[model samples]
Structures are given as C-alpha cells and as structure tokens.
Target: MTSTALPRPPIKGSRTQPIVAGLVTSLVGYTSSFAVVLTGLKAVGASDAQAASGLFALTIAMAICAVGLAWFTKRPITIAWSTPGAALLAGAAAVNFGWSEAVGAFIMTGVLIAATGAIPWLGRLLAAIPVSLAQAMLAGVLLQLCLAPFVALSTIPVYVAPVIVVWLIFLRLSPRWAVPAAMAAALGIAGFAMGQAGTTFLVGELLPTLHVTAPVFSLEAFMAITLPLFVVTMASQNVPGVAVLASFGYKTPWRASMISTGIGSSVAALFGGHAINLAAISAALAAGHEAGEDRSRRWIAAVSSGIFYILLGLASTAITALASASPTGLLEAAAGLALLGTLGAAASSALSDPTSRMSSLVAFLIAGSGLSFAGIGGAFWALLAGLAVRFVIERKRH
Candidate 1:
C-alpha cells in the first residue's frame, strides 16, 4: 500500500501569501511615502504635476531596488519612502530652494547613500547598534503613522472609525485576510455611503503625470538636502530597518543592505525619486507569518513587492485613479489600520528588554513628539536623547 505522503514541511507558507502580504504592506508604505512627497513638493513650489512626478520616481525606484535586493539576498528586504528624510527635504525646500534645487538635493542624497553603503566600516558600525535601541528607533519612526487612523477618526468618525474597528477585529482572527478585507470593505462602504451623502475625499489619480525638472548643482542645496537626507536615512530609516532584520533570525551582512539602499536611492534620485531606504514596518510584514519561515522563499515576497511598487510608479496615473476611486477617509483609514500590527510589534520589542527599557521608552517618546527645528525632525533628537541616557547609565554603572 502506498503510504499517503505526509504534508511537506511547512517551511514556506502559501507562495501567493507572501506576495499578497507584501502588496498590502507596500500599499501602506508607498502611500505613506507618497503623501509626504506630494505635500512636500507642493510646499516647495512644485506644481501638482511636478509633485506627482517626484512621487512617481520615488515609487518606481523603491520597487526596483527593493525587489532587486530581496531577490539577490533571498530575504524579505523591503524598501520604504524615507518619511523623515522627506520631512527634512520639505522644510529645507520651503526655506531656500526651487524645484531645481530640490532635484539637486535629491541627487546629492543618492550619492551619499551609495557611498555609505559601499564603505565597509559603516556597515560594521550599523551592526553595533543595540537591539533595544534599534527597536525603539523603529517604533519611533512608525509612531505617528500608526496613530493616524484614530486621528482620522477625530475628523471623520462615521466613515473611518467603523472601518478601522472592523479591520482591527479581522486582523485579530485572520491577519492574512485582514488587509485586503479591510481595503475592500473600506472602499466599498465609504465610497458608496459618502457618495450618497455627497461628501468628497482626497484620493489622487492612479496614473502619475511626469514633470522633468533639471537638477541645479549648488553647494547650498547639496549641503542642505543631501547631508540631512543621509543622516535621517541612516539614523531614522536604515538603522532601525537593520535592527528589525537582526531582531528576526536573519543576520545577513550589512554591506549588501547598505549598498542596495544607497544605489537604489542614487538611481532613483536621478529620475526624481526622493530617497529609498530599507522598509522597517513593511519588512515586519514579510518577516512575520509563515511566509518568513523559509529564508530562501522569503525573497520572493520582496521581489513581488518591488514589482508592484515599480508598476505602481510607472502607472502613476493608474495608481492615482485607483486611489481616487476610493473615498479619502476610507483609503487613509485602511493604511492606518493595516499598520496597527507593526506598530504594536515594534513598541513591544522596544520595551521588552529589561536593561534598555527606559532608554527605549525615552527614544520612543522623543521620536513620537514630532518636534522639528531648522528643518530637522525629532528622529535625530530621539536617538541622541536615548543614546545619551544609555551612555550615562552605562558609564555610571561601570
């Protein structure tokens, strides 16, 4: 009698599962990044179309590099929009630059990122960041984003809160289904109900309009945009992103990650993409669940996510169309709610380690404060405060 083949080791979950997970996570990642880019461009004197172009570049670049790195590493290496970096760019641009200057800044940022990645010592230094501090940094980066759903509810409760609640409940029981289900439900409910009620939400177009602005090379723009951009990407985005990977079982060398990020940012910037970095929250999505059990197959998730991001970038018009099709409240609420799991996970990790608990909490609070000075955001301060506190404590003990 032929024995029934036992179920193959569940080394990898459903092949499609990772792709879907990546897509959901990417939706949030890309949208969050694009929002900052779009608004930033507007604030910096870019026309609507120019802003869209910048966003288009960013999305396409993120997709290409993220997918490429993930494919190369065979790990869940996701790319993100560099939210903190964008904020810095926005403030700097508003103060002293036009679109050309902004593009120049973007170019400088790309070069810096690429250089850091190529340097051997930088990778080692990144590796030395404490696990708890890394986790705290991750939490700090994501804090505002995670809270946006409830914040949205404050402005539009009827449309957003219900959807958020339903999505949260769905997430608890069937996380795999939660994102898509939330997305579908949010759009269907909000679009129809809001349409009948005759309210408008700000959802952009699916196909993005391309606006090519020549880059103006200037020392001032370079200093303002590039230097700060690199700092934030390293401190706010990549450091925490690496930490997340380390927190999980994947200890791939930092050289590849840094190199990929640097190269991706540089290449993307040439085409107007703001800055691309390793995804922290979205990486958690791919890393968590059964999709992550097999390191080899996990690369597929990142690859697929990159493909989706590139497609989204290319079809900016189409992306805006799809997003615009949904009610604004619904779309924002969906992204905000989807990130709920990641927010909770990072927060837990940050505070869980006994020795670093206070320091981590301090980091989390400072990062979440949303304080900015001279176009710089709280990420730098948060890291500084936490590091200073940790140093003092360590010194005293010794």
Candidate 2:
C-alpha cells in the first residue's frame, strides 16, 4: 500500500521561496481588491481617468512605502491601500461628497494617520474607540457591496453567474485566489464584451497620469469621510497589521511606519487616491514561514512584492479601461466576492461580546440603512448612535 505520510520539508527554506511568496503576495493583494478601490473612487464622483489615476497612485505609493520599510527594518512589513477605507468611501459616496471635497477628506485622513504616530495621546484616543463599534461600522459599510453578487445574480445572471461559479470553484480549491480568479473571469468577460463593442484604445490610454486636484476641505466632508476613514484604516489595517507581524516575532516600527504611510497617503490624495496603511493580509504572507525559514532574510519577500506593485501599477490605466467597459454589475459582483471574507470577519467581531452586542447592532443597522442627516453620511451617524446607546445602557446598569 502507498504511504499516507506527509513529505518532509527542507531543513532550511529555499532561497527562491521568499521570492515566489512575494510575487504571490502582490498578485493576491492587487487583483483581489483593485475593483473595490476603483468602484469607491468613482462612486465619489471621479471620472474614469481620475479613478485610474487614483488606483495607480495608491499602488505606487504603497510600493514605495513597502520597499522603504522592508529595506530599512529588514522585516517583512507590507504596505497597502486601505481596502476597508475604500469600502467606507463607497458607502459614503451616496451623500454626494464632491470629488474635490473627497480629496480634501483624504488629505485630512492622511494628516490624522500621521498625527497618530507623531502625537502619542491621539493614537491612544483612537485605540480607545470600542472595537465592537468600529467593526460594526465596517460590517455595515460593507453590507451593500457584499450583497452585490446576489443582486447581480438575480438581475444579470447571464453575465454574473459564470463569474460566481468560477469564484466558488476557486474558493473550494484555493481560497486565497478565489477573488482573484473571479476577477480574472470578470476581466475576460469584460474584454470579450469590449471586443464585441469594438472599443478602441490609444497608446496614451494605456499609460496612467496623475489627476491632480486642489483639495477643498469642509467640516461636513471631515465628519463624513475623514474621521470614519481614519478609524477604519487604523482599526482594521494598521493595528491588526502590527499584531500580525508581532505574531511572527517581528515588531513593526509603529511611528515610522505610520508617518511614512501617512505621508504617502497625503501625496497620493493629491493625485486622486484615498489612503494607504500598514498591511494586515499581505504582511502575513511575507512574514510567515512560507516566505522563508530564515526569518531574518524574509524582508526580501516584502521588497519583492513592492517591486511587483510598481509594475502592476503601471497597468492600472489598461485594467481600468477593461473594467470601465464591463457590463453593469459584473465589477460589482467581483468586488462583492472580494469583500465576503472581510464582511464575515467584521460581522463576527461586531457581535462577539454580549455587552456591546446591541450597541454594535445599532451601529450596524444605522450604517447599513443608509441614513444621512445634516449632509453627513450614514457611517458617521452610525458611530455616534452606537456610542450614545452604549453610554445610556451602560450608565444605567452601572
């Protein structure tokens, strides 16, 4: 009979394993969520060209930041665009935050991130915000995007079903690539549809350019976009990223990392991007043993991924063009698949503690309800409502 024992691994990791892992890390990171970023930016009033520029800017900024951090610390500290923050933007865009106002909000978020590192008490304040509410808000913001697949399936099954089927097949076979595979399927369909439509592309359309906008700040945008974005990025990406790396026996340079990402975010905002932050998912990919057995040398994986990011970024315009041509709901279906895991995690966290369950539920409902008042978005109101409910209930019990 054939033995069922697992094969032994090499005593020392292969020199090339880290390189391969790095490539996979970037591939997964970019393919998995670029749709979300594009959708979010466009929902907030960005034109097709502007949205492409935003994606390119974010990709390049994260690449530079990741490379710099990994090279300096010799640790696999990955950087990424704020995926959750982008979703939050998607949800908030309904409030009609003009593109210029959104750009200003992005700058404000960048400043807040930098302040968290430069000012100690500020970080503490942000950390002190209840995790339950933060998670609840995130879940709520993701509600519509996550439901997009089923909606698309109902309305446009002819186009979206194949994408979902491919996603399901990959989800079972290789969960890491499920969303990317779905994205690929969607892209193929989009490209074919484009061919049928005889879409023409010029050489300039293939290259990305910056869509610089002078930021126009306002209190409404700050309250509606900036605070919620910063909170989501920090609670969901930065803090968890640090914890993720710490689990792998590496300490992230918190201040430096924050400052670098903050500056990168600000610069990218001027060019139509939202935010960048420490990476949670990609961080694990490069820091894990799969990257290399020699922990000290795993930083190379992060650097490799950063290099890949730069190259992938160059293709943003072409990719955006393909996405722009996709049949209605196709990109949404793809984005919804990409966000399923995140929605599940956020929902679970939001309801984990019984004490805060009702409060979090309040937040969840309010945010998802798309409630808006005084020209502010549902997410901001949701947080306030949740906090108020928590306070009232807790005080009475105390």
Winner by TM-score: 2
Residue 179 error for model 1, in Å?
Answer: 3.7
lDDT of 1 by residue, 49-160 (tens): 5666777877777777777777776778888888666654444432455767767778777777776768767656655566566557556656665666788787877777
* TM-score result, candidate 1: 0.66
Cα-based TM-score, every candidate: 0.66, 0.96
Runs of candidate 2 exceeding 4 Å displacement: 1-13, 395-398
Q: What's model 2's TM-score?
A: 0.96
For model 1, what is the alpha-carbon lDDT of residue 1? 69
Top candidate by lDDT:
2
